[model samples]
Target: METLANLESFVRSAETGSFSAAGRRLALTPAAVSRNVAMLERNLGVRLFQRSTRKLTLTEAGERFLASIGGNLDALQAAIAAMSNDHGEPAGVLKVSLAPSFGVAYVMPLLPDFLQRYPAIRPEWHFENRAIDLIAEGFDAAIGGGFELAPGLVSRPLAPAHIVAVASPAYLRERTLPADPAMLNVMDGIVMRSGRTGRTRHWTMRDAAGNEVATTMRERIVVSDPAAMREAALLGLGVALLAVPDVLPWIERGELVRVLPRWYADAGAISLYYPTRTLMPGKTRAFIDHVVEAFRRDGLAQRLAGSLGL
Candidate 1:
């Protein structure tokens, strides 16, 4: 019988593509991950991975091993969950990944209450703009905005995210407000890029006639961080296209003014996603339930609607 610890290290290292990354998730050192995998390889008497300077590729033997053991591993996890379910207490470390701005503005504030409720569960949070591979990255859950989701993940809607075009009061005072999407081409605009893809996202909007249009404005500044973009817009650097929830406080305080009111971009729904598995850990399940209930009770949608003057 394979030891659970060795099996876990093997599975995580295989999925993450690097021992260093797997180690980070497992709270082990790279050398420890390597040793664990080496032990597994010795017991099985075959090479699992083909290691090279640039990448780690699974060998035929490794692929077969993973296919054979994947279900057993899942069953083991489910069995553990079943055993722990009797306790009826959320106790464990919950690792979550989230979009930087939304995590800071909305989720972080709510976490204090959650932590207080579940004192036994320690939460580890990571905020980034890039899409995370939940299973491979060993994240228990992820909170994100936008529609595109990878396969084999279950997503639950958290809240509706509304976005609008905004500029500093100074910028609006000097330049004529763009009446339509076509006029935005002549103005300096800020664009956001994906850290992994290195491609700038085009702003999606609708005209007065309800025609869907995609516009990529000339970029005076390209920022990877959404918070930095908001700051730049506040400094009158350029027109900023931002999520309404993210910029609402600033707009309410008159630091920024909503531009192109007639043409508003559709704000994508914010969702919490996790790997599709038959059994979810108690802590993860509890956290998701808490988030849903909190958002419902807080009237987040109503608050957002009021902010947008809708």
Candidate 2:
């Protein structure tokens, strides 16, 4: 049988599309990954990848090889891990990706309790706005919304990704508040440019009564991050469309005020996403269970919807 290390290097390099990226995930040098892959290719007697300075493309043989091996790799890893140590207690780096503002505001607080329960599992959390390739990047799980579900991954609903118009109390001192979404066209708007698309996102506002209105406004300042947009709105610059979870604290503190109370944009449901595996790592399973239970207990869906009469 070929070395497990060689098989791992082959699989990681294939998933990430570059040896350098695969090396980062595997904790090896790019040269090391390349050498292992080369050894694997030699042993298998097939050209696995077409390498270029700019990109790496899987060869026909490589595609076929990956298709055959990809499904079983998780099982193999689990078997090896179980053989190496105690199988009852999960112990490993639990890598997770999260949307920064929402994760910090909500999920990060739950870490203390989670860690206390699963002390053997160490978390390696990344906070960012970009959609990550969970399997390719070696992430155990991710929390966010709007990511296209790739093959071999699954998502569980967490809460509605709701955005509402908000501004600082000081900013709206003399300005008249709009009664309807269409009236927002004349207001100074603080908006976010999509990180993936690089375009300013428009809003589709809905009321508690189920009335829908799509509106676009003149942007006073455009930011790439949600936190920055909240800051801009706090500075009394303009009205900003933002995730309710991101600005909930500010609103509660009376530093910011809701522009249209009943109106919100339905951005889709935020979810916890992970790879579908027969034998999931214990750390990952524990995290999912704990978080889902916590959300359920706290009524996160309704809270995120500002149902406490916020």
Find the 10 residues in a row with the least total lDDT in model 1: 301-310
Relative to the true structure, candidate 1 reaches a TM of 0.76
Q: Write the per-residue lDDT of candidate 1 for residues 159-255, one digit (tens) a residue.
A: 7676677889898887887767667887788878878789987767875476766766789999987788899999999987888777888988999
- Alpha-carbon shift of residue 268 in model 1 (angstroms): 3.4
State how far residue 218 of model 2 sits from its true place (Å): 3.7
Candidate 2's TM-score reads 0.81
Clashes of each: 0, 0
User: Would you list the C-alpha lDDT of every candidate in the order shown?
Assistant: 0.80, 0.87
Candidate 2: tens digits of C-alpha lDDT, residues 1-310 = 7888898888989888999899876757899999999999998899999999999989999999999996578778878665644546766788999988878878999999998998999899999877687876778899999888999899999998888899998889998899988989888989888867899999888887878999888987999888899999999998998888988889889999988887898889899999887667778888999999999998888878842336
User: Which candidate comes out best when scored by TM-score?
Assistant: 2
Off by over 4 Å in 2: 1-3, 11-18, 21-28, 32-74, 78-86, 194-198, 306-309
Clashes of 1: 0
